[model samples]
Target: MLPEEGVNAVRVVVGMLVRGEYEELETLTEARRLTAAEIAAAVRRHGRDLISPPDEAFRELGGVAVPREQADERAFHVDFPLWTAQDGLSDLTLGLTVAEVMDGVWTVELDGVHAP
Candidate 1:
């Protein structure tokens, strides 16, 4: 479950997503907007190589549903806070991703994260 603030934020983002408006996502600790591609690159560069490798520590927090097309009957959305456990540094930045909601949850195949 999300806190009051996170729940409110999700509401706003979900509204925007339904309208086909994709933009930066906000969390309790970080403030920035990141594209799906940008987030993927960052994760590959930092998290997979130097910082935290792909492991159980990296997990999905939650997801938001977005529209793929006005005509298409497919579903879409992005996941945030792909929490990756860190060593000494803060793990806030390690948790970020654009994921596709599948089977009532986010799919790892379509997810991407970033590191700071």
Candidate 2:
């Protein structure tokens, strides 16, 4: 779950998760790409502790499949707004470890979300 991988997963899930709410055109513009620095900055600005070290936890989870037995559990949960230049805003739940393994078991819950 490097930033790229996490973002990719989020994009896929978000698209599937929120398909009818927004048009295809709107969704494309909402796919935001965030750098590691940008992620760190947001965490700092929100006064939230880094759930796991920057790049460390995600790097470990990348390509490592979680066991099916614990697929329902979530290893990490992120509470933050996902920023995009065009569509403006969104929120994301970046599932790490077990949650990622289940593929679609965990649902992203966003409040006052303008876009998926």
Candidate 3:
């Protein structure tokens, strides 16, 4: 099993599958003041799982993903296989941060998906 923090973070991403479908959180928030490019680079460096193939990442959980979009600078799409047992593979958009792209610090929030 993953550590408590990892499970919590993943849960947040899974929860996003509910209703907000088009809103993506900005990697650069006014408070943090980091640029998108910087954030992306940071994420790329530290959060390989953030950009890794969905199936590859999900394999740790005994599941697989049907990728609709290859991970890119902004977002990626995967039918998450284990989010809901009844739903099976549910379509989910993994929102990208500039840090995730450029390789930034590995935080659960920074490495997580937002609404997309």
Top-TM-score candidate index = 3
lDDT of 3 by residue, 1-98 (tens): 33333333344544432322212323223314334454444334432222222444444432122232326322222333323233333333343222
* CA shift of 21, model 1, Å: 32
16-44 per-residue lDDT for model 2 (tens digits): 32332233323433423433344334334
List all candidate RMSDs to the true structure.
12.7, 12.3, 13.3
Off by over 4 Å in 2: 1-4, 21-74, 80-87, 90-98, 102-116
What are the models' TM-scores?
0.28, 0.26, 0.28
Off by over 4 Å in 3: 21-24, 27-116
Provide the overall lDDT of each model, using Cα atoms, as 2-decimal numbers: 0.36, 0.35, 0.33
The model with the greater TM-score, 1 or 3, is 3
Lowest lDDT sum, 10 consecutive residues, model 3, at 19-28
Q: Give residue 52's error in model 3 in angstroms.
A: 23
Residue range 1-116, candidate 1, lDDT tens digits: 23333334344443332232333332311333556445445545654323322333223334454454444332333344332335433343432223323333322222334333
Most lDDT-accurate candidate: 1
